[model samples]
Target: MESIKASLPDVIQQRIEDLVNAQTTDEEMAAHIKELGCRIAALEALAPEEKGEEAGQLGEAVHRLCERIRRDYVAIAYRQGLVDGMRMDKLAAEE
Candidate 1:
Protein backbone atom coordinates (compact mmCIF):
# COMPACT_ATOMS: atom_id res chain seq x y z
CA MET A 1 0.00 0.00 0.00
CA GLU A 2 2.69 2.50 0.97
CA SER A 3 4.92 1.34 -1.86
CA ILE A 4 2.10 1.80 -4.34
CA LYS A 5 1.41 5.27 -3.01
CA ALA A 6 5.11 6.06 -3.07
CA SER A 7 5.38 5.18 -6.73
CA LEU A 8 2.62 7.61 -7.52
CA PRO A 9 1.02 10.24 -5.36
CA ASP A 10 -2.01 8.91 -3.55
CA VAL A 11 -4.59 10.95 -5.46
CA ILE A 12 -3.25 10.24 -8.95
CA GLN A 13 -2.67 6.59 -8.28
CA GLN A 14 -6.06 6.16 -6.71
CA ARG A 15 -7.82 7.86 -9.57
CA ILE A 16 -6.08 5.67 -12.12
CA GLU A 17 -6.79 2.57 -10.09
CA ASP A 18 -10.43 3.53 -9.86
CA LEU A 19 -10.59 3.88 -13.63
CA VAL A 20 -8.98 0.52 -14.12
CA ASN A 21 -11.40 -1.15 -11.73
CA ALA A 22 -14.46 0.54 -13.17
CA GLN A 23 -17.01 -1.38 -15.23
CA THR A 24 -16.41 0.32 -18.55
CA THR A 25 -15.61 -0.60 -22.12
CA ASP A 26 -11.95 -0.75 -23.09
CA GLU A 27 -12.32 2.16 -25.49
CA GLU A 28 -13.83 4.31 -22.79
CA MET A 29 -11.11 3.38 -20.34
CA ALA A 30 -8.40 4.08 -22.90
CA ALA A 31 -9.84 7.49 -23.68
CA HIS A 32 -9.97 8.41 -20.02
CA ILE A 33 -6.44 7.16 -19.43
CA LYS A 34 -5.16 9.17 -22.36
CA GLU A 35 -6.82 12.26 -20.93
CA LEU A 36 -5.18 11.63 -17.59
CA GLY A 37 -1.79 11.20 -19.25
CA CYS A 38 -2.21 14.47 -21.09
CA ARG A 39 -3.03 16.26 -17.88
CA ILE A 40 0.03 14.81 -16.17
CA ALA A 41 2.26 15.72 -19.07
CA ALA A 42 1.04 19.29 -18.97
CA LEU A 43 1.73 19.45 -15.28
CA GLU A 44 5.21 18.06 -15.74
CA ALA A 45 5.99 20.60 -18.40
CA LEU A 46 4.91 23.43 -16.14
CA ALA A 47 6.86 22.16 -13.15
CA PRO A 48 9.68 24.31 -11.81
CA GLU A 49 13.15 23.52 -13.07
CA GLU A 50 15.46 21.38 -11.01
CA LYS A 51 19.26 21.51 -10.88
CA GLY A 52 21.98 19.11 -11.99
CA GLU A 53 21.28 15.49 -11.07
CA GLU A 54 17.71 16.13 -10.06
CA ALA A 55 16.90 17.51 -13.50
CA GLY A 56 18.46 14.47 -15.17
CA GLN A 57 16.41 12.16 -12.97
CA LEU A 58 13.25 14.05 -13.76
CA GLY A 59 14.00 13.82 -17.47
CA GLU A 60 14.52 10.08 -17.25
CA ALA A 61 11.30 9.57 -15.39
CA VAL A 62 9.42 11.66 -17.93
CA HIS A 63 10.97 9.74 -20.79
CA ARG A 64 9.95 6.41 -19.31
CA LEU A 65 6.42 7.61 -18.62
CA CYS A 66 6.10 8.91 -22.18
CA GLU A 67 7.27 5.62 -23.61
CA ARG A 68 4.81 3.67 -21.51
CA ILE A 69 1.96 5.95 -22.49
CA ARG A 70 2.91 5.73 -26.15
CA ARG A 71 2.97 1.95 -26.04
CA ASP A 72 -0.39 1.82 -24.33
CA TYR A 73 -1.88 4.20 -26.89
CA VAL A 74 -0.59 2.09 -29.73
CA ALA A 75 -2.10 -1.04 -28.18
CA ILE A 76 -5.43 0.69 -27.69
CA ALA A 77 -5.40 1.90 -31.27
CA TYR A 78 -4.59 -1.57 -32.57
CA ARG A 79 -7.41 -3.13 -30.59
CA GLN A 80 -9.86 -0.47 -31.73
CA GLY A 81 -8.76 -0.99 -35.32
CA LEU A 82 -9.37 -4.71 -35.05
CA VAL A 83 -12.81 -4.13 -33.61
CA ASP A 84 -13.65 -1.70 -36.42
CA GLY A 85 -12.36 -4.11 -39.07
CA MET A 86 -14.43 -6.92 -37.65
CA ARG A 87 -17.54 -4.74 -37.66
CA MET A 88 -16.87 -3.80 -41.26
CA ASP A 89 -16.43 -7.39 -42.28
CA LYS A 90 -19.66 -8.35 -40.60
CA LEU A 91 -21.54 -5.59 -42.41
CA ALA A 92 -20.07 -6.64 -45.73
CA ALA A 93 -21.04 -10.24 -45.14
CA GLU A 94 -24.60 -9.19 -44.45
CA GLU A 95 -24.74 -7.03 -47.58
Candidate 2:
Protein backbone atom coordinates (compact mmCIF):
# COMPACT_ATOMS: atom_id res chain seq x y z
CA MET A 1 0.00 0.00 0.00
CA GLU A 2 2.90 2.35 0.74
CA SER A 3 4.38 1.59 -2.67
CA ILE A 4 0.99 2.14 -4.23
CA LYS A 5 0.66 5.52 -2.58
CA ALA A 6 4.11 6.50 -3.80
CA SER A 7 3.12 5.56 -7.36
CA LEU A 8 -0.08 7.63 -7.44
CA PRO A 9 -0.23 10.81 -9.52
CA ASP A 10 0.93 13.86 -7.58
CA VAL A 11 -2.33 15.70 -8.08
CA ILE A 12 -4.34 12.76 -6.74
CA GLN A 13 -2.02 12.25 -3.77
CA GLN A 14 -2.15 15.95 -2.96
CA ARG A 15 -5.93 15.91 -3.09
CA ILE A 16 -6.04 12.99 -0.68
CA GLU A 17 -3.64 14.71 1.66
CA ASP A 18 -5.71 17.87 1.50
CA LEU A 19 -8.82 15.95 2.43
CA VAL A 20 -7.03 14.34 5.37
CA ASN A 21 -5.88 17.76 6.56
CA ALA A 22 -9.10 19.69 5.93
CA GLN A 23 -11.11 21.22 8.76
CA THR A 24 -14.79 20.67 8.04
CA THR A 25 -17.94 20.05 10.07
CA ASP A 26 -18.03 16.48 11.41
CA GLU A 27 -21.50 15.74 10.01
CA GLU A 28 -20.44 16.80 6.54
CA MET A 29 -17.23 14.85 6.75
CA ALA A 30 -19.00 11.73 7.95
CA ALA A 31 -21.59 11.93 5.20
CA HIS A 32 -18.87 12.38 2.61
CA ILE A 33 -16.86 9.44 3.89
CA LYS A 34 -19.95 7.28 3.98
CA GLU A 35 -20.72 8.16 0.37
CA LEU A 36 -17.15 7.37 -0.62
CA GLY A 37 -17.24 3.99 1.11
CA CYS A 38 -20.45 3.06 -0.64
CA ARG A 39 -19.06 4.04 -4.02
CA ILE A 40 -15.82 2.09 -3.49
CA ALA A 41 -17.69 -0.96 -2.27
CA ALA A 42 -19.99 -0.91 -5.29
CA LEU A 43 -17.07 -0.63 -7.69
CA GLU A 44 -15.17 -3.41 -5.98
CA ALA A 45 -18.16 -5.69 -6.01
CA LEU A 46 -18.56 -5.16 -9.74
CA ALA A 47 -14.91 -5.94 -10.52
CA PRO A 48 -14.15 -9.40 -11.85
CA GLU A 49 -12.10 -11.58 -9.49
CA GLU A 50 -10.21 -13.83 -11.90
CA LYS A 51 -7.78 -11.60 -13.74
CA GLY A 52 -4.80 -9.54 -12.57
CA GLU A 53 -5.27 -9.69 -8.84
CA GLU A 54 -2.68 -7.02 -8.17
CA ALA A 55 -4.21 -4.69 -10.71
CA GLY A 56 -7.63 -5.17 -9.22
CA GLN A 57 -6.34 -4.43 -5.76
CA LEU A 58 -4.50 -1.34 -6.97
CA GLY A 59 -7.50 -0.10 -8.90
CA GLU A 60 -9.73 -0.59 -5.87
CA ALA A 61 -7.36 1.36 -3.66
CA VAL A 62 -7.16 4.23 -6.12
CA HIS A 63 -10.92 4.26 -6.50
CA ARG A 64 -11.32 4.41 -2.73
CA LEU A 65 -8.85 7.26 -2.32
CA CYS A 66 -10.32 9.23 -5.19
CA GLU A 67 -13.79 8.77 -3.80
CA ARG A 68 -12.67 9.92 -0.40
CA ILE A 69 -11.17 13.13 -1.75
CA ARG A 70 -14.10 13.82 -4.04
CA ARG A 71 -16.64 13.22 -1.33
CA ASP A 72 -14.87 15.29 1.27
CA TYR A 73 -13.92 18.27 -0.86
CA VAL A 74 -15.85 18.23 -4.09
CA ALA A 75 -19.15 17.32 -2.51
CA ILE A 76 -18.77 19.92 0.18
CA ALA A 77 -17.92 22.55 -2.37
CA TYR A 78 -20.98 21.66 -4.39
CA ARG A 79 -23.19 21.76 -1.35
CA GLN A 80 -21.81 25.12 -0.33
CA GLY A 81 -22.40 26.64 -3.80
CA LEU A 82 -18.72 26.98 -4.53
CA VAL A 83 -18.98 24.38 -7.30
CA ASP A 84 -21.82 23.95 -9.70
CA GLY A 85 -23.92 20.82 -9.73
CA MET A 86 -23.91 18.53 -12.74
CA ARG A 87 -26.42 19.50 -15.37
CA MET A 88 -27.37 16.18 -16.82
CA ASP A 89 -30.41 17.62 -18.51
CA LYS A 90 -28.28 20.15 -20.33
CA LEU A 91 -25.93 17.41 -21.42
CA ALA A 92 -28.78 15.34 -22.72
CA ALA A 93 -30.20 18.33 -24.58
CA GLU A 94 -26.82 18.95 -26.17
CA GLU A 95 -26.78 15.42 -27.49
Candidate 3:
Protein backbone atom coordinates (compact mmCIF):
# COMPACT_ATOMS: atom_id res chain seq x y z
CA MET A 1 0.00 0.00 0.00
CA GLU A 2 2.87 2.33 0.77
CA SER A 3 4.43 1.58 -2.62
CA ILE A 4 1.09 2.33 -4.28
CA LYS A 5 0.77 5.59 -2.35
CA ALA A 6 4.33 6.55 -3.28
CA SER A 7 3.57 6.14 -6.97
CA LEU A 8 0.34 8.18 -6.89
CA PRO A 9 0.40 11.81 -8.10
CA ASP A 10 0.99 14.18 -5.19
CA VAL A 11 -2.37 15.89 -5.50
CA ILE A 12 -4.20 12.58 -5.57
CA GLN A 13 -2.29 11.30 -2.58
CA GLN A 14 -3.12 14.42 -0.60
CA ARG A 15 -6.79 14.32 -1.58
CA ILE A 16 -7.07 10.67 -0.59
CA GLU A 17 -5.49 11.36 2.78
CA ASP A 18 -7.79 14.28 3.36
CA LEU A 19 -10.88 12.27 2.44
CA VAL A 20 -9.96 9.44 4.75
CA ASN A 21 -9.31 11.81 7.66
CA ALA A 22 -12.26 14.12 7.19
CA GLN A 23 -15.62 13.58 8.85
CA THR A 24 -17.40 13.05 5.58
CA THR A 25 -20.76 11.40 4.91
CA ASP A 26 -20.84 7.98 3.31
CA GLU A 27 -22.24 9.33 0.05
CA GLU A 28 -19.46 11.91 -0.16
CA MET A 29 -16.75 9.38 0.61
CA ALA A 30 -18.10 6.90 -1.92
CA ALA A 31 -18.34 9.59 -4.58
CA HIS A 32 -14.79 10.74 -3.90
CA ILE A 33 -13.49 7.19 -4.10
CA LYS A 34 -15.19 6.64 -7.44
CA GLU A 35 -13.78 9.92 -8.71
CA LEU A 36 -10.31 8.92 -7.59
CA GLY A 37 -10.61 5.62 -9.42
CA CYS A 38 -11.62 7.41 -12.60
CA ARG A 39 -8.76 9.87 -12.26
CA ILE A 40 -6.28 7.03 -11.79
CA ALA A 41 -7.66 5.19 -14.79
CA ALA A 42 -7.33 8.31 -16.93
CA LEU A 43 -3.78 8.84 -15.79
CA GLU A 44 -2.91 5.23 -16.51
CA ALA A 45 -4.40 5.49 -19.95
CA LEU A 46 -2.50 8.69 -20.70
CA ALA A 47 0.86 7.29 -19.63
CA PRO A 48 3.28 7.02 -22.50
CA GLU A 49 3.34 3.54 -23.96
CA GLU A 50 6.92 2.36 -23.86
CA LYS A 51 8.58 -0.97 -24.60
CA GLY A 52 11.38 -2.11 -22.30
CA GLU A 53 11.99 -4.18 -19.22
CA GLU A 54 11.77 -1.15 -16.91
CA ALA A 55 8.68 0.15 -18.66
CA GLY A 56 7.04 -3.28 -18.46
CA GLN A 57 7.74 -3.47 -14.72
CA LEU A 58 6.45 0.02 -14.13
CA GLY A 59 3.34 -0.69 -16.14
CA GLU A 60 2.68 -3.82 -14.13
CA ALA A 61 3.09 -1.90 -10.90
CA VAL A 62 0.73 0.83 -12.01
CA HIS A 63 -1.83 -1.66 -13.25
CA ARG A 64 -1.78 -3.55 -9.98
CA LEU A 65 -2.15 -0.41 -7.93
CA CYS A 66 -4.96 0.93 -10.07
CA GLU A 67 -6.87 -2.33 -9.84
CA ARG A 68 -6.39 -2.46 -6.11
CA ILE A 69 -7.70 1.05 -5.64
CA ARG A 70 -10.68 0.41 -7.88
CA ARG A 71 -11.55 -2.73 -6.01
CA ASP A 72 -11.28 -0.90 -2.71
CA TYR A 73 -13.57 1.81 -3.97
CA VAL A 74 -16.14 -0.70 -5.13
CA ALA A 75 -16.09 -2.40 -1.75
CA ILE A 76 -16.58 0.92 0.01
CA ALA A 77 -19.47 1.84 -2.25
CA TYR A 78 -21.11 -1.52 -1.71
CA ARG A 79 -20.85 -1.25 2.06
CA GLN A 80 -22.15 2.29 2.05
CA GLY A 81 -25.09 1.33 -0.11
CA LEU A 82 -25.90 -1.59 2.11
CA VAL A 83 -25.81 0.52 5.24
CA ASP A 84 -27.88 3.25 3.69
CA GLY A 85 -30.46 0.75 2.51
CA MET A 86 -30.70 -0.76 5.95
CA ARG A 87 -31.10 2.67 7.49
CA MET A 88 -33.88 3.50 5.07
CA ASP A 89 -35.63 0.26 5.78
CA LYS A 90 -35.44 0.90 9.50
CA LEU A 91 -36.82 4.39 9.07
CA ALA A 92 -39.68 3.06 6.97
CA ALA A 93 -40.50 0.53 9.66
CA GLU A 94 -40.73 3.30 12.24
CA GLU A 95 -43.14 5.39 10.18
> Estimated TM-score per prediction?
0.40, 0.34, 0.41
TM-score, cand. 1: 0.40
lDDT by residue for model 2 (3-95), tens: 334434653565577668767668876786777667656666676776456555766788677668767776665554422113333333445
What range of 10 consecutive residues in model 1 has the weakest lDDT sum?
Answer: 2-11
Between candidates 1 and 2, which one is better according to TM-score? 1
Judging by lDDT, tell me the better candidate of 1 and 2: 1
lDDT of model number 1: 0.62
Pairs that collide in candidate 1 are none
Kindly provide the TM-score of model 2 when superposed on the true structure, using C-alpha atoms.
0.34
Q: What's the CA error at residue 34 for candidate 2, in Å? A: 0.8
Evaluated against the true structure, the overall lDDT of model 3 is: 0.62
lDDT of 3 by residue, 1-95 (tens): 44334434653555577568755567875786678666656655666665344555565676678668767877886786676566556655555
Question: What order do you get sorting by TM-score, best first?
Answer: 3, 1, 2
Query: Model 3: residues >4 Å from true position, as ranges?
Result: 1-51
